[model samples]
Target: MATFLRENASELGVRYVIWQGRIWSRGAGDQGGWGRPYDGGGVYDPSDATGGHYDHVHVSVRR
Candidate 1:
């Protein structure tokens, strides 16, 4: 992913690229330490405390 981002950085106007994993268990909430959400969706809310319901890698590219 890094290679691809770097190769196309000029045309893509990429500024930041984030590669992360998703949650495998529903009981898993945002670990907070790794900047990964337990739900594998959006920003996690600590107040929910319900944990996440999905799992997958999160790839974000910022221009």
Candidate 2:
């Protein structure tokens, strides 16, 4: 799913995506896509199953 979104990001207006503790942003470009890891911080509880987004994918779209 991440690969598909990254492939068509321009057409889909995808700003970024968070999944499996990693993040990919259009602004960062392909070379850095998903290279950055996302720590839950205060938003997601690391102790929880879905806190690190291990069970799901979070897609952020541009308006």
Q: Which predicted model would earn the best lDDT?
A: 2
Per-residue error (Å), model 1, residue 16: 0.8
TM-score of each: 0.28, 0.76
Clashing pairs in 2: none
Q: Cα lDDT of model 1 overall?
A: 0.40
Best by TM-score: 2
lDDT tens digits, residue span 1-63, model 2: 977887798999998877777778876744454637677767897446698777887888989
Clash number for candidate 2: 0
lDDT (tens digit, per residue) of candidate 1 on 22-51? 222222333564334344245764234332
TM-score for predicted model 1 compared with the true structure = 0.28
| Candidate 2 error regions (>4 Å) | 29-33
Model 2 residue 13 lDDT score: 97
Go through the candidates in order and give each one's C-alpha lDDT.
0.40, 0.76
Candidate 2 achieves a global lDDT of 0.76
- Candidate RMSDs in order: 10.2, 2.6
